[model samples]
Target: MRSLKKSLVHMLSVPLLLSLSCHSFADLTIDGKPAPHQNLSTHDVKELLADDDELELTPQGSTTASTTLRQSNGAPPAMHSGVVDTTFMNNAGPNVHAGSALVMDAQTGEVLFSKNSNSSRPMASITKLMTAVVTADAHLDMSQDITLEPIDFDGPKKASTKLRAGDKMNRAEVLLVALMKSENPAAAALARTYPGGKPAFIAAMNAKARELGMSSTHYFESTGLDPRNVSSARDLAILVTQAYKYGVIRQFSSTPHYDFNLGYRMLNASNTNALVRNGGWNINLSKTGFINEAGRCVVMHTTVNSRPAVVVLMGEPTTQARNTDATDLLNWLTGLPKDT
Candidate 1:
């Protein structure tokens, strides 16, 4: 009976000893050196732990201090991983007055300079570029004449056009008017006459945007009068590049002037983009837009420094400001005089 009692006592003492051992270890210095209980205060423990690199615990549960700190704090304020951040170099080049702008290499899709390139804003008449693309891609009968109707005039904003309610023009001619002169009614007519009508035409525009990797672009109407027709400078650059692929779009957009006759009367229209009409630069594709919400907007595929490039300028305060912004960009790229 005494032997059985002694065995139980030994087992209980064993657990007590193990607990004491753990408590002793917890009271020691973080470097594994023996420390008195009085020296194991919270401050002392923190200091010891900080000095002992191997015992340091990181947010990621790793012992590497440098990497852990960097990961915890994130990248520096000025560093941009993927998109171009022009904050540092805003003054390095010409002073651009546009609210947002982008210059990209058309051949390689490389961003040359960007300021808020991903910010979406109303695109104004530049929306016609997508309208032209969708119309051309549909392979509609270009010679089929479409009569101007009151429905085409349906929009919140009234657009100026010489075509009367009963005036008639073929699809190709209307497309030219839309691209060259930015005629809102002509663009709406193109969409209205599409196989699935305006809804399908708008759907095709968005579908084309997706196909071209314009993730930040959206279109609500063929004419850009709706402030809802919005896109970013980056997306517009992609658009200008894609639109340049179509020979007809390039031809029509770059045309200096065009005349249309309604048999009883003649309506003459000129390209809204003065750069195309001025013949001062080699502009392969050009489109301009304006609305109260959109400001002055322009997108072009032109030669910069003898290399193909796409330039997008949006939210300029005035028509001259938009033109000046484009000229300044071209001059900077091509090494022209700063005063030019």
Candidate 2:
């Protein structure tokens, strides 16, 4: 009985001692071997505060900047090393800028994030995305030969590509250049041959916009070159999502460069989406747009820090500013919660 009692006591004592050992180690890591139940040294508190670089941004130079986020006495003021917060977006960029921007959840269309997204403004060639979707949906014979009519190039609007009355090409090939290359004449041709003409084609574009649940969108032209064609950033995000449904639309929008033939000449088409051709991004879908009235713009579907990300910038004063906005947004996103 004595021997059995000794074994039982040892078993109980082993776990109890192990538990105490773990508790002690967790309660205090030995640095300068402080005694138990005592306050941590000032040096220890400083070490805790100096944990890994939390913001993950180290600015280029030693010059430091901090905004007064709060003024509660003895409290740590909020600070960030880079990028604009979601709460103060409109004020971050150019003072002359006006227009909404959005970054949405692609699958559910649930608005994960928004910035003045409902304010309508000219969309520029971003309209070509919708035009491409509608043309692909029309199910017209892709192989059908479209003989370029003199009227195709004769509209009051200035022409971007020279196409004469006699030039001919297959419909699908032209739509490819229209969408991928943003060849204005090709888009005009596709719209012209639809049952009616420019007027009817535009009506269909508006109807399609309504179908996509775009409330503030209006289309005065098929290609977005016409400054009168306007849509809110909220509406454009939906337009972009619908445009992604067509496989060719996604493939062509991501294309950085291609060779295209206009009856008389073969020209190289380069994507305006700087980020795709840009070495830094993993861009799956993208498009850049502009007109003097619209300012510079870009909408891209991509991934940052292993999470789905949509970065859109508009109304930048300079072309460089648009690029800077995207870069800043991406850097902010990579540090946000749920990024991994």
lDDT of 2 by residue, 1-340 (tens): 3342232222211111111111121121112232233222333322322321121211110001121112113232122212222423312332224345565434333343445665677877787777776776666555567777766665435646644567676665566567656667777788898878777788889999887667767888777778888776666766665554344455556655554455467555566766655547756567777788888877776656545445555566677777777776666655655511
TM-score, each model?
A: 0.73, 0.66
Candidate 2 to truth, TM: 0.66
Encode model 1's per-residue lDDT on 1-340: one tens digit a residue: 3342222122211111111111121221112232233212233223322332222222111111121001112322222223544532222566778877887656544555677776778899999999988887776666567898998888979878777788787666688788988988899999999999999999999999988767668899999999999888877877876666554566667766655667777676678988877878877679999999999999987765446667889899999999988988887777632222
Q: Please identify model 1 stretches exceeding 4 Å from their true place.
A: 1-91, 336-340
Clashing pairs in 1: 125-289
Candidate 2 Cα outliers beyond 4 Å, as residue runs: 1-98, 108-113, 154-159, 162-167, 261-264
Kindly state the number of residue pairs that clash in model 2: 0
